[model samples]
Target chain A: SAVISQKPSRDICQRGTSLTIQCQVDSQVTMMFWYRQQPGQSLTLIATANQGSEATYESGFVIDKFPISRPNLTFSTLTVSNMSPEDSSIYLCSVAGQGVGTQYFGPGTRLLVL
Target chain B: AQRVTQPEKLLSVFKGAPVELKCNYSYSGSPELFWYVQYSRQRLQLLLRHISRESIKGFTADLNKGETSFHLKKPFAQEEDSAMYYCALRGTGGYSTLTFGKGTMLLVSP
Candidate 1:
């Protein structure tokens, strides 16, 4: 398992504002995943960020709405643009382990839109 | 398409009682099941994975391909065992993406 951390563990932002959540991993990883868990809801995949390539977004996620930057193997950023109340959720970043089907999660960034 | 289902939102049990957290998944390819636990104010950590077929912190989950289920079990409950348990599934392949369940809140009463 890798040690992962997220910045701005919890934040309150006004509507239409944007917040960028940063994820840092202790070791280099080939794949970084972003997930959002809404209040009382299941975790949903937002995107997969791979270094040196544009992120691959999930079905309901888009680059324009949730932009991602995989600047390097150990870091990635997810920026929620034009945020609204519905966008409030706990955003988490995770990294896959060396073994297949294994993943470790970060502490998660809790976002609240006012 | 892949999905994990945890039917119980909350499961309350008295200390020393047996505990079981039900999980079911749907996937076209070979499925791998995992149980993750998040204690209060703690990051989510892996409790058990079907591939390992091993127990951690007194918890074990058996993968029943026939029923499409992978329910977590513990012979005896401890107060410290209380936490949010999430069942996750990853399809067989190069893809490492995971589909997580809604999570079940386990409350072990002393």
Candidate 2:
């Protein structure tokens, strides 16, 4: 099992503003992911952040709207850009441990865009 | 495309009652299924996985490839067992991304 933490546990941002959520893992991991959970909706994968490479984003999510940066194995960041009311959701960061299928999630960042 | 479906959004059961949270998945190849739980103020944590075939915190889940389902079950539920549960699938493809189902909130009332 791995321990993960996210910064800005909860934030209220004005529309059109941007907020970057940080994810830190206690151990180095090769696979890190970003997810979004909207009100009453399932957790949706936003992107896969790999160290020193471009992130692989899922459908319906674009790089321009949610940019990701993973400078190293233990850290990654997801920036919600040009936020709107619809973008208000709980953003989660998860990391998969080596040779294991289980992924541990961070304490989600609850963003409320006003 | 891999997908997970959790039919129930909420489930309420009395303490010490049997509880089952249904989860079904759609995947072509071998699937790695997992059950994650989130307590009221805690982070989402892996409760159990089918591949491990082990029980955690008195909870267990079995993968039924024939039915394409992996449902979580617990006998004699406890009040502390109340939490938001999510069923997730890991695709075997190179990406190793996880697709999660809509979570189920289990309310074990004492």
Best by lDDT: 1
- Candidate 2 per-residue lDDT over residues B19-92, each given as its tens digit: 99999999988889988899999988878889889989899899998999999999989999999999999876
Per-residue lDDT of model 1, residues A18-111, tens digit only: 9999999999999999999999998898988999999988899999999999999999999999999999999999998876667889999999
In model 2, the runs with Cα more than 4 Å from the true position are none
lDDT values for all models: 0.93, 0.92
Restricting to chain A, the TM-score for each candidate equals: 0.98, 0.96
Worst 10 residues of 1 chain B by lDDT: B90-99
Best by TM-score: 1
Q: Flag regions of model 1 displaced more than 4 Å.
A: none
**Candidate 2 residue-wise lDDT, A1-114, digit = tens:** 788989989999999999999999999988899999999998899999989899999889999999999999999999999999999999999987654557788999999999
Itemize residue pairs with steric clashes in candidate 1.
none
Can you write out model 1's per-residue Cα lDDT over B1-110, one digit (the tens) per residue?
88899999999999999999999999887788899889999998888889998979989999999999999999999999999999999854457888899999999999
